[model samples]
Target: MPRLLLVDDEPSQLKALQRTLRGLCPDLHMDLALGGEEALTHLRARAHDAILADLRMPGMDGLTLLGQAARWQPLAVPMLLTGVADFATAQRALNETGIFRYLTKPWEPELLRAHVCAALAEFQHRVTQQTQAAAWQAEQGVLSPQELERLRLEREEPGLTHVEWADDGAVLMPALDAHLPSMPR
Candidate 1:
């Protein structure tokens, strides 16, 4: 199940939204926060897949919360599901907060569901990529000098010949491709 954090000041709005989206994302685990401060508290409580936040709120607005969230959990997909979507507000949110999505007020249920799914997919992809990168780094730690040199050579010359002088060419392959003859003058 995808864990979600929703931040808003209005209790009624929060409840309605939760109800509506709950039906939308049956597999989603949703949590509520009354304001940005509460949202941060919830964030610190546990790791969540995504965050949906309002732009306007009392004490530590969504943008501030997003900035802090990024610092704490860089992989978490934080989105601005706000009513306010003016040019300046959008610009500020995109530039300053690193928002993944900006969903305007009175958004469609289907659209909301779509966005949530996309965000969750992106979240999963990021986690997978991070895991793979970490594994590669760990494996690299066990490599011998010869293996490291082979990797460097493969990177530097995609189709390097194993033959004669190139200063110190790491022999990536035992023999160069026989298909391509040496260049004609």
Candidate 2:
């Protein structure tokens, strides 16, 4: 079962959402917070698979809270809900904060449930990938200094093609001689 946190300043709105989500997602363990501060408190106590927050609030807004949540719990998927449909705010939330979804107010219960389920699935996928990568790293011991340097260079220069090490530890790369810019030959 996935854990979720929902934050809103309005008590009535929070209660309504809570009741609806609980009915829709009976398997999900949901927690409600009155404001951003209380949300942060709940976040610090335990990790949640997803967080849904209202964009407008008194002290700490949803965007700010999401940012904090990202730093505190990178695995958790963050989402924003706002009454107004502001493109600029939505863009910022998607680009800067990496919000999973931006939902407008008066949301349909089914749509909200679908978005929450998708976010939970995504979070689970990420966690599984991280675990697999860690296991692979453990099986394959640390890379050589030369290989590490090559990897660093490859990351720095996106134009470079992929490179792999052979069984004998030889570096192999695609033939880029013909693709190179013409020289004054």
In terms of TM-score, the best-performing candidate is 2
lDDT (Cα, tens digit) per residue for candidate 2, span 76-161: 89999999988999999998889999999999988998998899999889777765655565568655556555544533332243
**C-alpha TM-scores of all predictions:** 0.73, 0.74
Scored against the true structure, residue 126 in model 2 reaches a CA lDDT of: 72
Candidate 1: Cα lDDT at 124: 89
lDDT of each: 0.75, 0.81
**Residue by residue across 45-130, what tens digits does model 1's lDDT show?**
56678888888898888888988877656667989967767888888888997788988888787888788788889988987886
What are the runs in model 1 whose C-alpha is more than 4 Å off?
Answer: 142-185
Taking the candidates one at a time, how many backbone clashes does each contain? 0, 0
Worst 10 residues of 1 by lDDT: 154-163
Assess candidate 2 and give its TM-score to the true structure: 0.74
